[model samples]
Target: MKLTSYWLDTVPRFTGTPQAALPGQADAVIVGGGFSGLSAALRLRQLGASVVVLERDRVIGEASGRNGGHVNNGLAGSFTDACAKLGEDTATRLYKVLNSAVDTVETITRENGIDCDFTRCGKLKVGNRQAHEAALQTDYARLTVAADPEACLLDETQVREELGSDLFSSGLLYPKSARMHMGRFGIGLANAVLHAGGLIFENTPMTGMKRTGNSFEMTTPQGKILAKSVLMATGISRNAPAWFRQRIMPVGSFIVATEPMDEAAMRRIMPGGRNVVTMQNIHNYFRATADHRLIFGGRASFSRSRTTTDITSGNMLLAAMRRTLPELPDVKIDYCWGGDVDMTVDRLPHAGQWNGVFYTMGYSGHGTQMSVYMGQRMAEAMAGMPDTNPLAGRAWQKIPCYGLASHFLPLVGAFYRAKDFVQEMKE
Candidate 1:
């Protein structure tokens, strides 16, 4: 199997890269050309701002391209617990904004006419063990009452009908969840930015930045830019701003894609055509592509990303896929890869200004849509619409005594595994 992203391999490369040398002056210079940075450029142009996007790699080359293509409108963690921790009013507002982010992604797909197979196929949060079923029911109860009236609980029999899998005991179905071809969406978003007269510099990394009077001066490998403001939409790259690095933890998420399967096999395993995710501290998510290929992904381990670990993770994911769907025997993995996901202490996205730089990060594993929303919001914030930011005025919590690498990941993974073992025993 190729150690590359199936999404990136399937879509055409973005050809509209800017050929001009980086301008000495721009209204805004965006760091990182993932979904957040690209979407921000599109919105900033609509607001009549001259924007420049600087990407260290190809646009959407990192976690944005390597993801499982879930535009799911759910929180990364439990909603009821979030309400209990932050109070219902605060949590409800944040939850609703994330739900709106899903709507924003669908709206963009429609408005741009991007043929990314954007589908509101809904989402199924399935329970692997018995106690997990109770948790799913709890999430269904709280979410339906708080944010989504379209959410509901499904028993084992109903889940079996929907998924044809005996591994899950129950599920929580969120009807607003969606999926799409992320690579195509990324290219489409890049075209949108270009169509709006924005400049994109692929393979250009921001090397340095300093305050120059009213504007910030950013030095890239190819050229430099002076901007009235800067947006740090950089994903979980180890080379990022110091302020951002302190608060964000880069966790490696791994995935493997099976070769295109027959329509009959797709129908037998996943009749509902929804994203299926099991409830676990270290979760496993699987869904079929528009081409009928099953893409399975997970936080296979808490260790940092490496070639060997990616292959090992792919093997583990294949085993999990078989356990979930015994009907798919001898499945051939066509692709395997890994990328870093930026996570926060609270596991919620934060958008605000640090010094002269506007920024957003900590999407955890739910960035597929929320990052896009934060991009639009960052544009609004830069255009004097600070209230548009859903995660406004939130303080970012930093990791203790760690920088760059998460040295304690294996210990954290072991703790979660032990907890899972205990939970399984209790069940």
Candidate 2:
């Protein structure tokens, strides 16, 4: 499919130094150039390690550039669900790690002088139904207890006032959360990595990787990179190593960008221009861009291809938006696009070593913040300091379904969609 207008025309351009050819060898080699790989490279370079990054496309070409730009806190699942799956102590540690992750991204952007339009406007996880309200309340309590003192719950009226939409029954405002220009952010990080003396090779896809003795050899179309260690940060690309592909399923999610609107129009939808996501199983996340466009995103599909001119997904998202704000029915959609999200069976991100090669992906929709944190953690882990690592000895052990996610994702998606439909009907 041809790239959509949103992706083709709307994303910010990078004026950084041009990418260089793949290096012959490095101290550390990264397979992907999205948030995880670039962040990892930056941190590794800061630690005085020589690094090389291989990107299949130009930087910010896929999910990292195409998401809804919500720098959300915590994992994708509810805090209660996380605690249930990982236990209270483990889940609490994970939550703290992720909360700090959000701040880490902001700090990196600021310290490096990256102009990514990052704003700490907070995030609202809104409830769409009575049942959802109960879940939201429980989540609010759990998150408040797990969160810092600044986090608080917003009642229905407060949610309405904050979001300027009555569609939500309640909201849990994560004060530490923020929004960003994802595409620009990706470019900024790439530039930062380059400025720090790390090498990035654009349009260089990894064809194969093999573990040899104590090091890994990564083969690309143009050349091969041999390094002491390799990090796989390919979020949803099917071209990943076989062992890596088995653990994560790449589900496609679409997003639509409305024509630029005035501040009054934007405020009518998202008061304070804070990012908002509904509390549904198949949730919808939206945020106003720095350009005042309503970037509404949701609606998952199993299709592997997307058309630039096709507005079907965009129309569907607009209809969903109008269901909450009847005043915006005629809002013109300027761009529509889709990207793959790496989802795991347990709905938690996977970050660990596989086959002597370190890797991190499958954040679901929580990549914006968690990706940065995982990258930093992965760097620290590679530096021979596992005991003090944040992700060490956690409940993030490999799940049984990790090996089946890629093969059974369609069935899994259908089941989840059915669950979402039933829940939406109950609303």
Using lDDT as the measure, the top candidate is 1
Q: Cα deviation in Å at residue 391, candidate 2? A: 3.0
Compose the digit string of candidate 1's lDDT tens values, residues 1-427.
9999998998999875646888889988899899999999999999999999999989999888999889998777778888888898888888888789999988888898888999999999988787777777787788888887888899889898889777788888988889999999999999999998999999899999999899898998887789998999997766787778888888888899999998989898998899988887777888999888999998785656474787888888888789778888567999988888888888888889898689987898889999899999999889887478878777788876756347888788888878877887787
Clashes (N, CA, C under 3 Å) per candidate: 0, 0
Question: TM-score per candidate, in order?
Answer: 0.97, 0.90
**lDDT by residue for model 2 over 134-237, one digit each (tens)?**
87778777777775456667778888787767677777777778988787678889889989998888878989888888888889888888899888889877
**Model 2 clashing residue pairs (backbone):** none
CA shift of 30, model 2, Å: 0.7
Q: What does candidate 2 score on TM?
A: 0.90
